[model samples]
Target: MRPIAILSVLAGLSALTSPAASAQDRPPRPPAFASPEVTAEKKVSFRIHAPKAEKVQLSSSDLPDAGRGLDMTKSDEGVWEATVGPVVPGAYRYSFNVDGLAVIDPRNPATSEANNNTFSLVYVPGSETSDAKDVPHGAVAEVVYPSQTLQRPRRMHVYTPPGYEKGEGRFPVFYLLHGATDSDASWSTIGRAGFILDNLIAAGKARPMIVVMPAGHTGPFRFGGAGGVSFETQMAQFEQDFVKDLKPYIETNYRVIADREHRAIAGLSMGGAQTLNVAFGHLDEYGAVGVFSSGVFGITGGPNGGAPDTRWEDAHKSTLDDAELKKGLRLVWFGCGKDDFLLKTSQATVEMLKRHQIDVVSRDTVGGHTWLNWRDYLVEFAPLLFQGK
Candidate 1:
């Protein structure tokens, strides 16, 4: 057997040699590092155990391949391991691809859930001491509001700007949306919007404001359910939910600028399309709109068709062609990663908007269709959401 295997077996035997040996008497396990270390030179190691699987790979947003990952060498006990090169200190989320299935580390508790795959999060030390409390922090709260449109109680997330608890000032509001595969918690948990915005505000780079992240999944033309709906009908239901139900709840519960100029909507992926549909269709309600890596312009067919039809003509009729969106909208922002599959469609939308004499702030970044890109966009977009309007 290999030297490492021999050492492992010997270590295991050592624990069994003593009748009084407890779980704590065994050798301490290796440190499981996920995020990059903060020093100039840093190394990250990841491991997973799937003995029955023939192949396994480690994937991460900071690395490549949608975090789908690197191959792991199996041990006699069925554990697999891989190490990453030196990286800058920051927080990162990762997962393991076991036989083409993404899985989180069973040992780690810091996780984010959007689907079947839970993420493993790591916080690396940075320029400051790892536990320094120098930075001012904000708080997050998940809220539920009565939805008259859907006839149910809908939940959402709210991020109160730092110093909000000490002041009586009413803040402007930004309604941010998440993609199809995500829920309301994506902005605060996975995207880290609260932290990013708090940093920006503390640095005087951004003004204090309220950000409301609503659940944007709307089912078919049906009234009560919010799932398994056609793309077109889903968009319509989202509009009703936002304008009729969500807006009133925010205006009543939170201290906000309850008018058009103070309201903005932005989202990524399917949520991006929803942003366009909600803000543009109800131009009288929101003065600013943002669509990030959105696949809105191409798609057709109803629920009868496959889930993600790319025929734009059929899915986006009323909202996409509205003239008021161009006339009344104060700021329209569009962003996408240069390497994203939806780049062409984003560019095409910019051209169409320009042809209609509607100006927009178009941005491109170095990323694909991952949350890393979305997190970066949140860092850049939050300050600009309700500023000029």
Candidate 2:
């Protein structure tokens, strides 16, 4: 070999044998973290390999100390970890906050999507409501339909009960609504409505019905709007779309009884307010109504403005007499957690309905305004629907 080529080859060999190059050529080391591990006892142990993080904590939805950050301790390996409860059987959303920044669990793939935030999900099996049992499952579909009322396209989720494909018979329909910030998918994903209904129906505790979950927002209207448009306007548009567009679509496409006796409307939080407004206004349309963790803020206004055309209270009172209402209305169910912020409003609304000669079925559970309470409410409310029809 030439002298220059010999020197170049020696340099190349020296570089290849260097410690940094040898380290780079070696296979990467596996992660040392074991996170979000569910133990046999149902306790969830979470860990994050953030050696340089100043602090780390875990926040969860509806768990014992939900919304409050549970402090995580650091190990000698520089990993932070915390073991949460023998958690109840359910699907839960959670995230890790490291040095004031929120992030999803890198180790867990199960997640929930919301308008504002995405969270990691963990399911603990055992509870009757959340667990997947050895029973037939219902089908859930994402449906998009034109909205003449809103002058745009809208999306909804429809849940058909098991054995619906066989075309056994026309079923009752439940219009389930989500809260202010949630979308139509909230019920099926995080709320576990499908599982709850399946379990209930299989046990013969509740009647099988088609569940229609529609988007609560209508155009520019939203919860607590600050611009010239009021929140009521948005609600009115939603009610219009629900009554005119959504109802017609369901009746035309699905085998549902299109009358008051077999129709029901129910919601949570803001949706509960919408339920009171829509169901009460259309007594001839919906026989049953379930309101969870919310109530009419006042009697003077409703989804529509105070105009005679849009006032739910006025319409409800004017459309039917006491005897007619008593005969037509089947269920007026009200549910709220004992510690819910809306407890007073719910109780007051129940009293108001009773004063108006409406029989209200009231239920107070032990939790706050979380999916836990909403799931319980649905379990109780679904059985009461379409009965004696």
Candidate 3:
């Protein structure tokens, strides 16, 4: 063969033997780790590649029947794996504990709100109520406003229903509140309030309205400390801030019907207590009130504290007068989970309301004090607002 022909052959051999060419010839790499894989059967398989870790465990916000806080086994390749549920269709927050250190799944990008402590979020789409469908979605905006009562700046998450921007007509408003330790963003993020409202409104199950989720913490009020402010004083400040500052800001900014008949207030846990405290007194401001997974628990202090003074009930009794409440209030709903520790408080409050001859809608939903129950409460409560007005 000629020298040129030999050189061309050598070049071809080198091209074939190159690392890039050899890579193509080799077997395809295994599929990258997909943590929290929801299977067809509704089971979820969680995986994490932690080779050096001695032990890793999985903790999830799933229901008890769905196998929460299960131990994961390590594979030969150093991947920790566990499968849980046949879980019911809904969104869940989960995290991995690597040898006592709680961490989020590195492979899962979906996450809950940072205010709720930022956990890996997974949604098993099934029901139209909780799932995001091909319907017109609402817009959520994080708004900052000055709190004159608290004498500081604060943030809130506002949700305007579909067609809010183009429409000239003013809509009803739902002032929603979050639980303790959760910020204003909790409702739209972890509770999925935006999607829930969108689905309900698209299906005509609920009326389109603006939702205002405000930060429940008005000022720093520590529990059981020398310089700590009393719960009553803190609540009074919050009420002043909410009614004076927040309400005026929202009414001035948003195109909402600013009347008692068109306004509603609802909350979960700590916010629930605040709801009862604030709305029960001001029946002229809110036509509907919803308290979920909480009652007069924190207001009077939890079980550790002594029984709430009779003056507490007396004050609400004075404000929630039977004739006034009947004349102005459209709905006064209270709900708690069967497994929730606050069940007794809710039941007692319901009895008290009934004794005052004020009609109350009491719901005993399934599950504990989790976001599942809060979302369900919102679904049930939103339709009741601004209805028959």
Candidate 4:
């Protein structure tokens, strides 16, 4: 062996056996991956490395108190880390408070799936939809219809029942409404209305019926307007827009059952008021009505309470009266959470209907007026439609 080569080999071996090794003598090891697990019953830890930041904080909407705010400490390579304790999962919306500016976790790629800027979800154990298996589900689509009332084209979304696009069978239709400060996209985006219906239809709980979601806000109120003042006029305009323009377009474009017996209407909050004003008043058009949270009449029976005083005929001059409601209406189903701001209004509407000998299926829950409550209401309500022979 050459003396130089032998000496080099001996030095390398000596370095391995010695307490310290030369700078070039050691080989690099691979980086380590983080293995973190969480359960629904217990809390989970989350760590983020952001070493250069001056201050870091964590905030979550689900937590009663502000989330654990971490002051990041620098590592050898100038990386900062923030660690927080276990949190109950179920799609927790959280953001990092970096220097007082809220930010989503850049290291986490899953938050990108939602396409939301300020919020991210953490799926905990035992979520109903999270736990459910992939089954045959319905489809949702965005569609545009011509509107003569607004003097422009209108856009809306529809969720077709399972086997609808493929099969030759005709299906019933339900026209759903969204609340104020929300658009036609609200139901599909936040509520997951299509997914909920798909699950129900797959389980045979709901009939194969087409679901339509429409924007109920009209005029300046659409952008942002207060109730009691702009609501009546705006609501009236919405009714006209729905009946004169939207309805005809849907009938022409889709293979929907056009008769009143095959059509229904429902909504949440401001949309709920629209549901009652439009569906009940125009019972000749919509056979069934689902009223959630908001109602057309308040308990006081005054002009702004919920329903009109004296009689509904005087309040809604052109629409049908109570006697007509009894003749044309098939079902009036209403639900609201006990803690909802609109609870009293919903109760008053129910009493007014019942007093006029109108039958109703009323339900109440314990949640505040929130999307989670509404989603569950839909999960329950979808099955009740088109049940009778």
lDDT of model 1 at residue 373? Answer: 78
C-alpha lDDT of all candidate models, in order: 0.72, 0.83, 0.83, 0.69
Q: How close is candidate 3 to the true structure, as a TM-score?
A: 0.85
| lDDT (tens digit, per residue) of candidate 4 on 223-298 | 3344332766777788899989887888877878888778888899888888877876667787788988877644
Clashes in predicted model 2: 0
At residue 203, give the lDDT of candidate 3.
90
Writing each residue's lDDT as its tens digit, candidate 2 over 30-60 gives 3676668888899988888887899999998
Q: Which runs of model 3 end up more than 4 angstroms from their true locations? A: 1-31, 63-68, 114-116, 218-236, 298-308
Q: Candidate 2: where is the Cα deviation over 4 Å?
A: 1-34, 219-233, 298-316, 319-322
Alpha-carbon shift of residue 196 in model 4 (angstroms): 1.4
Clashes by residue pair, model 2: none
**Each prediction's number of clashing residue pairs:** 11, 0, 0, 10
TM-score between candidate 2 and the true structure: 0.84
